[model samples]
Target: MTANACAPTYSLPATSAPLPAPKQDPVRTLIDELLAEQQRLQTPVARFSEAHDRGASPALEPLYRDLIPLSKPGPGEQYAFEVDLDSCTGCKACVAGCHSLNGLDDEETWRDVGMLVGGTRNHPFQQTVTSACHHCADPGCLNGCPVLAYEKDPVTGIVRHLDDQCIGCQYCILKCPYDVPKYNDRLGIVRKCDMCHSRLAVGEAPACVQACPTQAIKIVTVTTHLNGQPALDTTAFLPGAPAPEYTQPTTRYTSSKPLPAEIIAADAATLRPQHPHWPLVFMLTLMPMAVGCFTVAACADLLAPRYPLLANLPASAPTTLALTGWLAGAAGLFASVFHLGQPLRAWRVFLGLRKSWLSREAVIFGPWFGLATATAAVPLASQLGLFSGSADVPVGSVSSALASAYSLLAAHYSLLTLATASVGLLGLFCSSMIYIDTQRHLWRAAQTIPRFFGSGAVLGFAILFAAAPTLPYFFALLGSVLFKLAIEARELRPLDSDDDTPTASFKTAQMLTGPLRLPHNLRVTSALLACILAFALTRISAPSLLAWTIPALLLASELTERYLYFRAVVAPKMPGVVSK
Candidate 1:
């Protein structure tokens, strides 16, 4: 009992004071405070909305404040790009911004940067140029579109492409002097810079303007008229760019220093082949051949009865030729359909008939096809006894009516042939006008008119001679072919000139003799071969074989020539870097 009492005598400790809290690390304490503060902050969307409601300026406002106009354009005025050459450093930030903000394809850019170089050895100079759609006072793309796929805004004067309305004919590409409109392969349509129209509508600068670090590009109001009339003074356009007289481009390039007199594009000497446009090549070649056939058939039908040499022609010859022409025309028209990126939208091609030669060509050819079909089929129908009847049948009877109708058609058949040929000739004129209107030096009226019509004449005479094997047809073929070859040979004259300037003609000459020399030589060789075969046909009797061979050779020559037409011609553009 005593031991137990002693063991129970141990004392319990009293409640101890709280131990001192471990000191917090300074970095951790600061981080915790920041995390709590961040939790209380508003989201970016809420902040932006609050700022907008309070009329606070955007973060980017200061960056693009001077790049855009303070007010909209007034009467006789329009918005245009004004570039300060002295301020530009050739940085491609504008291009990147345009592509990103516009959501353009990876390889596509509305803005382009180029270099201009000139001056003597002692005073060499270089300038960087940035360019995009000029939004001209008179736009060639709008004027040449066969479907009205482009429009200039009435108030702002921005040239905008209507993507949905475009058939992707790309005629506007050829029409535009500065090569502004670009084709989008994925969309099967053309797209261009509309000056970031939607952004401008919301009082924001264009992507290019906003992103240019040096503030080299700016939007400004410019006078689009003179003496109260819509006229443009294009002297303010860039010096090393395409001529502004054609489209009246409004982009103004300013510099403190005067440009060199001999300033030229960096890429002026580069030789590159253009798109072949195979469908157009086929359409052009075949349609002209069809026109020639119809024309020759008409002439033969009219003169055969009067001239003894032609009188020997078989009665089926005219009908055969007309049929051949109709077939060719049909094939050409079909091939043209393939040329359109949006073939289904081509129904609207006639909408631009007021300004577009392509539209006129389409409209005129539609009826020409119908007339040609009738011309080809009517005679065949008569030969098949569809219009045959005894003249002595009772008057007013169907048989008597048929006989009368047949006789009337027989009397006016030559006239019908003449009319069809005339319409086709007119369509061909429209075709030639399509290229001539482009204002390219290689596609001027003098070159295009003769080339198109001459091709028709040569091909036509070749076909007629093949059918009749007559001396007149042979001579006509020889003369027409020789004339066409002579016209093509004139393209080489610039090569012999002492002047070494890289003008369009000189560039064309260089292209023909350079990379395109193989095709050019083949064209000439085929033409000569056709001529030789034509002469041989007169000496030898091999109508079936020579007929096909001669026309085939002529066709090959014409196709090659048309290929060279597109390949050798130098397109005018802004100065660019030398192509690798």
Candidate 2:
């Protein structure tokens, strides 16, 4: 207390007054004033000249003058493009204008000009259609985004991509019908036409609109109901374009000249498969196969006691099953990282789980991986004598109790197996949904679900046959192989005549029979060989050689089958040059 009382008191210092900034030299001050006056006088004339250079003519200015107030739509209103197809020259001025004004990459374009041609030779008809982001009533890009990277303005209905928030997964590119969004590889993000929203906000038309020399492209106010007018119907679209009712695309195309009933895209006959996504192919194949392995082992163990055929088989050790599942699941997941433009930002994949099937796939697979790892680790821990068996000294009944618990856990291996099996199945389902959600004919659930699940079934049974040499397992493997082949064969059948659009069906068939024919033939050959080997392995005493060989053949066949699956898919895109 005495030492505390002896502490010195601090004194409060008086504050000084603030000093004013020094005055500029008279000569410099006079010069600055003169410069300001000169800039003010030059600004008005410069602005008018700038607008004139943007492709606005005297006749177009009145409409341009009136369009500014309506550019940014008010509440419950929406802005859309009205294209007068008759006046469009396919000059590509709009495309160039958008690219330059938006500062897009050299290889990237947000707008495109497509030619629709169809009519009698005597009355020939060809029309150029300029298309950009439709900003649809149901924006697929917005709905499919994993990270909520896309947003449609409630006020103006302008679809905008939030670049900083994007992980560059490219799911939106797949979802968009018009193919408006362009991925910037250097920036590791996606950018799209916002209809020059910044320009619109300042009472100016979009760059594309202003740049149209013939005034073919113009801004208009449309009711929220895209189907509000008959002009927006499917009949208005060019050939090979998706049905307007699907996304209710807001861009309206009109022409005074009557187009033929069978207008076709100039590039409709072009056969181009989506770029081979190697990481996706590996992840899709290996992860499901891993899940199948876990499920088969678990089911085999659970059913072994009940079924006579499953009895006395050489099932994989729990350690092997756990470890295989762990490795396969982890490897598939790691490989998927390379598929993203910004792999470092892959953690954002979970952000779109609510609406994006791609996100759901990530979320579900993550748990599957964790469970598999834990299952593998338990057996490893027991082997290392970390949980049970020979330790230095007994602590108490707790240690003895843990030792007994460990033994019980080791005995009840089916518990972890069942859990891993459950999660693996869920992961497979999520994977199927990733393609199913695209709504592409080739990737429909009827096609993708069966192929995906059947792959797991075939590979899982093959694995089970190897793990435990059993007749039922071999038979199951043989049956699944045949079933999968049947499904693929169905793809060869002529497309349904009753279906409204057969372009996709025709394109898919061409891909399968044309480019992928050799692979398809080899796949069937491999499957047949595997089946023959499986049958022969059952009869021979030393079946180890055949056991390993059959699975290898089966895996090769599966790889080929998956390659075709991706190779034959014709993703819907806006018509463009074949090289694009």
Per-residue alpha-carbon lDDT of candidate 2 for residues 328-435, written as tens digits (9 for 90 to 100): 778888888878887777888888888998888888888878777767776765656575435543334346666675566667767877888898898799888877
Candidate maximizing lDDT: 1
Candidate 1's C-alpha runs over 4 A off are 1-63, 383-408
lDDT by residue (117-218, candidate 1, tens digit) is: 999999998999999999999999999999999999988999999999999999998998887888888888889999998888777778888777677899
Q: Which pairs of residues collide in candidate 2? A: 146-352
For model 2 the local lDDT of residue 93 reads 87
| Candidate 2 deviation (Cα RMSD) | 13.1
TM-score for candidate 1, residues paired by index:
0.87
By summed lDDT, the worst window of 10 consecutive residues in model 2 runs over 225-234
Error of 1 at 246 (Å): 1.1
